[model samples]
Target: MTEGFLSSEEYDEQAHRLYDVGDYDGALEMLKEGLALYPNAVELCVGLGYARLAREEFAWARRAFERAMVLDPAHEDAMVGMGEALLRLGHRIEALRLFHRVEQMGFDDDIELMLTMGRALYRDGLYTQARDVFGRAVAARPDSAEAVASLGYALHRLGDDVGSGRQVRRALRIDPDLHEARIYLGHLLYDRGDWEGSLREFERVPPVEHWDALAVWRILELKRALWHMESGDARLAPWEDRLRALEELDDPIDRLLAEIESEVAEKDGLALDPSQLELFSGRAEGGREHRVRSPDGHVYRGSWSAIVRQMRDAAGFGHEPLSAFMRRMAERWHEQSGVDVPFRDPEVFLRAAVEYRLMFLEDGPD
Candidate 1:
């Protein structure tokens, strides 16, 4: 049908489809056209609010939401949209009040609204509140894998690893094909020193489905350690390529910030323990048997166990057991990256090692 003939609801539907597929600009244009024809269309205003929110135009989003609310004060979606925009604008208390108002208006059991509000809270680092919101969503729809897994992630961020694991596993049982939750469970298992469990969860996710660099890195480390796969092994080619592709997609600014943070971490670590200066010193130089290069270009060659041994040996701490050295390095990595790296297994140790730029695999004679 011609644009002039299209009803406001039809325009809203088209815009919703575009928004879902990440076509924010198209959604905005369509909503603007619909609003021009149907100036009093509350749904069109709400759609515009969400589309603007998707593009992170928080002020514009709030204006659209406010328009929708003024046109229809009881509109549930407009209230939630306004709350989301407020949260993004750093008006936490105001956002919470708006969300509370929506809940009190009988949207307390709205599964989608609850999930949206929970995600907004989680993104703003309010994990405890996010967990409660997600819990409400789960309660509203007990079998919702998305709600359960979201709750699990919120719990994980709040440091309740055990509860997180339980909730994630429950979500997996509800929907095994939820790859995001599966990947999260894999990391949780790896953190708890369950190599076989972690590998099982990760392997279930096809390599093409693996989008996160951290997950792909863990897969590579697990394969090398568990199966004794060589760096040049054909089986590792897909995952290695995936890792490379993901790294290439990383924001240059983010990469620079991470490098700077790593440098700052090393310096702070050195201040805490003068002996760690050796680990950071000559970062881009050194190597031997089974040579491999860290992300920062530091080289270390040998068995995975020997790699940690070599790091300490170079620092004159060779007398320390390999496990102890690995644990110490893992602790330092956690301090820097806030990721718990399990060191009980050599390959797992290298997973976090490679991630935090402590060490990584390179082609060399085994």
Candidate 2:
């Protein structure tokens, strides 16, 4: 009975069962033998292609699936398999054409095909098109946070920053554990110079019990960098003990401090005045304006006025006369417009303000 000749149907059924059970090697062997007896069997070719795909032999899989498509052009599985193989081979346009063919054949239920097309569009930087495809995916499955996040990322790439922010926030509202959305939001805030807001957003991420430690370390490093920039201090002694407490961090804050120190050294070496180091020491009180030639041969005026204002405010000057002046200006602006201007950290605000005043003196306000 074991040696009995099996019919084509029996062989095909056995091949499919073997494939279903993840025995790709066994399935390939059986299909190879079966194909010899039925050389033109399209199903057998598809089975062989699937076995090749399971084994990650994408080129071989493409050849087998193309043969299956040639034998039976209307074979949906063969078309999808060929498209996937082409996509893996980086023939994105050809793969999208095949996917479009699949769609034209009334296979709208193919969520995997849609996702593949969307990803291809994303890689090509056709983000608006990608967003449309991802929108369809969301419509098909409203509860999919992955789809929502993908759409949000597409929108962000397309320069719809506000829309992207809203989409990511919506994803977070739907699923608070969506780490990607949280990180993207943090990045948007940081780019806008909302350092405190960005820090608050980043801190919402829980400890990395199962998440990637590198991501957490990067966020913490960014926070420390912002703090150093605002405080104009590099000693790190005050935060040294707290940094040690974060033993689980893969790359410690001390490493980040060392990198910052190296960067300061490189930049400081190019400075014209050594005494100007006092500006970064948090001791300077007045803004300094300078005309410097940019590396691109562009002559531009740069000012460090904001740094002076920050130093003045931080030097135990509680409600000083300058503070009142700034308050009056802020209040006057608020009275003219309903929107309140965002106040930077004392040091940063002062530095930027002083720099602006110097620029006004040299270039005049535009």
Q: Please tell me which predicted candidate would have the highest TM-score against the true structure.
A: 1
lDDT of each: 0.77, 0.60
Write down the lDDT that model 2 would get: 0.60
Clashes of each: 0, 10
Q: lDDT tens digits, residues 1-366, model 1?
A: 234589999999999999989799999999999999999999999999999988768899999999999999989999899998998788999989988888888887888899889888876667888999898888888899989999998899888999999999999999999998898889788768899899999989998887655667778889999999999899999998987665455332334444754877777544435644333333322422355575544455444444554455433233344555667667767787887887765545675566665566675333
- lDDT score for residue 45 of model 2: 90
> So what's the TM-score on candidate 1?
0.69
The lDDT leader among the candidates is: 1
C-alpha RMSD of candidate 2: 18.5
- Pick out the ten consecutive residues of candidate 1 with the lowest summed lDDT: 279-288
The residue-by-residue lDDT of candidate 2 on 35-93, one tens digit each, is 88888899899888878877768899999999999999988878877876786666878
Global Cα lDDT for candidate 1: 0.77
- What TM-score should be assigned to candidate 2? 0.45
Clash pairs for candidate 1: none
